[model samples]
Target chain A: MCTVCGCGEGDTKLEGQSIHQLPPHAFIRGAGGHHHHAHTHSHAPGMTQARMVQIEQDILGKNNQYAARNRQWFADRAILALNLVSSPGSGKTTLLTETLTRLQGNVPMAVVEGDQQTSNDADRIRATGVPALQINTGKGCHLDAHMVGHALESLPIDNGGILFIENVGNLVCPAAFDLGEAHKVVILSVTEGEDKPIKYPDMFHAANLMILNKIDLLPYLRFDVAKCEEYARRVNPNIQILHVSATSGEGMEGWLNWLQQQRP
Target chain B: MHEMSLCEGVLQVLEDEAKRQNFTKVKSVWLEIGTMSGVEIEAMRFCFDAVVGNSLADGAKLEIIEIPAEAWCLNCAQSVAVKQRFDACPVCGSYQLQVIRGDEMRIKELEVE
Candidate 1:
């Protein structure tokens, strides 16, 4: 039987046999199925141009519900949660490592590191003496709200502290689903082209803050720092841009100051 | 990669709807993908084939309808098609705009037998 539409076994006729015997939509049907009508439409045995549309079920509805619950939970506890998104090798882990190291013992912090198949980022954060949870997504490209809920339950976070969720390294898929964080921080490396914000504007536009990482390497590469900032601002004028070099600690103090201000 | 998870969600909803309506088999599935949702339609079709195996939606034809991006212009007080969220109003150069459509990913309808 035909699969595209479910109209194969009707009383319609084609060349010799019933319309079902012919391929789908072989004959042209007019407005009334005869000749001389206001509209000349094509119709086969089991195919009609009439679009069937009525049912409405939001695909992301379930995920959004869970995210709302997670957001409520975070708000109730007065926890400052941030979801970190960036491309691969954008220094997300390195920057996070520096942030945790500098804020260690000063503020109670927890980390949820998401990766395709490794605990290396979690291990790096654990070395800083803060609670860390490693979520191996297997083949999944992004972390959803349900995964964050589970990771939050496993990690030991004190009241009124920072919760950093390092999402899987993808600028596209991660922007679609919210992980119930207070802010979405997009990290960009100087090595990546300035057109990144324009090509992947959804991530840049969705982010509340944009961090330009690897500034110390600016002297070696031909990356235009001003153009990068301009493109990001063009996409999202309200996005706060910060430049930092995770290796040399050149811009770490400003980032630390922002972190301190988020504390409740 | 995340497409498989999305397909799984679709199958779950299909099962629930089938049980509620007492349908034996699903003939077709109509899906609406928003431009701003970041879901690749080709990947979704492939994932639908793989994840629907041995399920109620097995052998179901997948039909995808794309939704265009629409934003509400604060200055013009009109809704218009836009490529991105931060796009200025075509009528007036104002950045203050609210996105009203094209951010949804949903299953519109399913033809069942």
Candidate 2:
């Protein structure tokens, strides 16, 4: 069972259900009286013409609208919202917990966690005494702007503070979504392939910064740090790369410094 | 699937336009999807069929116009056609290609009544 949205397993219903009724249609008998043809027309006179409507609009326009609203909301409150995205098992939760633990009392921070199921990540965040809200996407692969806006209602964020939105453990779908974040920080573990940036070029191109985690395991694995940076730069010329190990606390200071610099 | 939510977004636009333009039903929808948009055409069609059910656009035909991805080769200093995001320049065989076009996902027009 999902905790945040109260959605249970095996449930496939869509949210915000709306009742719709079919428009009036008249079935007219044919001249031979052997067939019936359905005719649908407008009730108002002279308004039944089928015409082409010029609607040149983006398919993600609605989500962008919600994202813009969230952006304005953050701007008004002086909140620096960072969206942390990475593949599953890249150690995002670990990094977040460590960051929160290190910056405790020095910064007023709140976390919004996203996952396909389970609130274990949020629970982990709360264990560090930081406020966290979990958004179980259920069958959703990523969180949209509308969902994040709703989550913000229950999450009490501090002014002039940071709001870390840990996105679902997916690379493709999340790249196309904008949850009103100031910057997208993509994490790449040293345990994974160095060519991940090129493999998932869309995610790498969309992200402003790429955090290479699990540097402590570099000696144990054949993950090429330089190759990874080169691939990321090829995808995005201006992407900032950081090497960090949440487990060993290596490069945490630089990560923390980057976060502090983003604040207003 | 993200395609499901994208179909839902299209429905929202149709419904909003119905109120603003005084149209009760939609007959067809034309979408301009770029090759580099990362949206699978078959997946989008399936999601559209499922999402438009019981709505004003129920049974509405979806017509997709695929926009080919375009990029500028820094080595050749000319615009070139490419398939994927990481595609090297076709002219100079350089990986320094900067994407200039494509990645559009838009509803260009609609047939409604």
Candidate 3:
């Protein structure tokens, strides 16, 4: 049996009771062929359209509930949780390495690295001497709150620590789910086009902070930094943007300072 | 894509409803995906076909409805249509805005027989 919730195959007694229950109006199938309804006008050959009229269902509600519970747990521990989202090769790992190197020993830190297959990022963080947990999503495009909750159980939950969750490298799917983070940071590399923010506005709009990484490669690449910032601001004017080069450590002080201020 | 996981969630809900109401099969599904939800409609549709192949919703048709991003402008004290949450108010051009809606990806209803 799964000890946490007593849910697996070993706990057949608890599993016997089905949690699926229909609403009161789930029936009421129309007798005639023309079951006209205002909300759902379309009709199938055999299926009654009225049955589909009123279904007040919230699909993601269950996930949101778990996320709320996780949020409360983080609050109780005074952990500053951050969820990082970006595309592949966006320098999220490099930025995180630099951040951990700068903030190590100054503040207690932990990491939950999300990837489709490997524990490479987690290994990198472990090399930094801080406690890190790796979650191999295995074809999963995003990390939901439930996964984060499991990662938290194994992590060292010291008081006033910062927990950084590096979401699977994708700009689109990761924004939909909340990982009980205090803030969502989106990373954009200079090698990527300046139109990335405009092309994927949803990711930029959902983020609280945007990090313009790979500034060290600016001279080699044809990326326009001002245009990139402009498009990002157009998508989300409230987003705080910081330029940083993890390789040269250029413009990293401001990013570190911002992170330090977030620690409770 | 993440759609397979979402389809699995839908199947879980459908199976729960089926067991409760003694229903047999699902005919169609109505889903509402917000602009800021970060879900690709095409990918979701593709995954729906693959994930529901052996389940009760085996041949169910998936209908996706897109919801535009919207926010409440504090400066103008009104709700306005927005493409992004942080965009300034269309009328007032103020930076102050609270996102009131358009961050939902949900299964609205299921048509079962």
Candidate 4:
């Protein structure tokens, strides 16, 4: 998708009309690769009293529009969409794989995996026998709403199904981009610093829940669970914390129950 | 890298406004970026030129108005300046600080022809 404008990446069409038409800047880079400063062609000498347009617009206005549409789509289907975010190697895929394996017969699920370059994660997900689509962002840092909306059209998720949009494993960039998910689940492994929530306040603040994963390894790690939760609460008081070990299947039932509670 | 996308957003806004105001060219843009918005000014500026290169805002001067981070200390009952998100309240040294402002990224105005 056009990550910058939050527009569909390819020539996405519904029936006969293009959906989320390309933004104007796409045409900018489309025409040339250079900045033209030679406004001297029409200079009226001095400042020329250039008109000031009071455009108090947010930079992410377009992205928010895309997100709103995506949100509505999910709502219409009663689909439980979750944007899974965290730093690289924080057990997002592991947790997801395990969740899918356990809940396979209980609930319908699909996944849209975001990676810089690779179908590896999607392949792993598909191995669990559920539909999974891979989104190679190339140089893109995060998965924006536009890309997820496009993925939704291809995934076979139906009403009352769960859609997991596993965002690129970056705590920083993904914090700002909303994928129209019902909630953002951030996973932090025991190996990571306990103060991560404070360090990356934006991501934690944006997240609705924090999954402290790899608790099975906590016996060998020095990660302070209480302090971590404290820091998380310091930034986001209402962020629910889940201690789970995808490896050991600990706390899986609670996770599943939480998912069930969110279903419409 | 994310800054590149942000610059693209700036260009997109300028392009939209151009149509609304009937300006054929853009001369300058003033943007307000808060310190707590998690955006880097250096990186944003570096990517701005390239992102706006062929767009309507091409060669347009980017004037950034940096807004300082502000937080309301729950314990102190007053808003205080914060250098970062996790800063302790300057008055009470408490972590019960709520962000009040300085988290917005908005285009304040545009100079166009």
Shift in Å, residue A150, candidate 1: 1.7
Model 3 clashing residue pairs (backbone): none
Q: Which candidate has the highest DockQ of all? A: 4
List, residue by residue over A115-207, the lDDT tens digit for candidate 4: 877688999999999899888776678987777777777789868899999999999999998888899999999999999999899999899
Per-residue lDDT of model 2, residues A115-223, tens digit only = 8777799999999999998877766788778778767877887898899999999988999999999999999999889999988899999999999999999988988
DockQ head-to-head 3 vs 4, winner: 4
TM-score of chain B of each: 0.89, 0.96, 0.89, 0.96
| Fnat for candidate 3 (0 to 1) | 0.30
Q: Each model's TM-score, in the order given?
A: 0.79, 0.87, 0.77, 0.89
**Model 2's TM-score against the true structure:** 0.87
Regions more than 4 Å wrong, model 4: A1-49
Query: Residue pairs in steric clash, candidate 2?
Result: none
Task: Give the higher-DockQ candidate: 1 or 2.
Answer: 2
- Give the Å error, residue A227, model 3: 1.3
RMSD each, Å:
13.1, 6.7, 8.2, 4.1
Q: Of the candidates numbered 2 and 3, which has the greater DockQ value?
A: 2
DockQ scores for all the models shown?
Answer: 0.19, 0.48, 0.25, 0.61
Q: Where's the lowest-lDDT run of ten residues in candidate 3 chain A? A: A10-19
lDDT of 4 by residue, B25-113 (tens): 78888999998899999999878876777666778888999999899888989999998776888887888888989989999999888
lDDT winner between 1 and 3, please give it. Answer: 1
* CA lDDT, candidate 3, residue A188: 92
User: What lDDT tens digits, residue by residue, belong to model 1 across residues A1-264?
Assistant: 333222332232211233234442211122232222233355576743434435698776656776888898888888889999999999999999889888888888899888876678888989988888887765567887866765665578888889999998998878878888988999999999977897888899899889999999999999998888877876776889889999999989999888778656
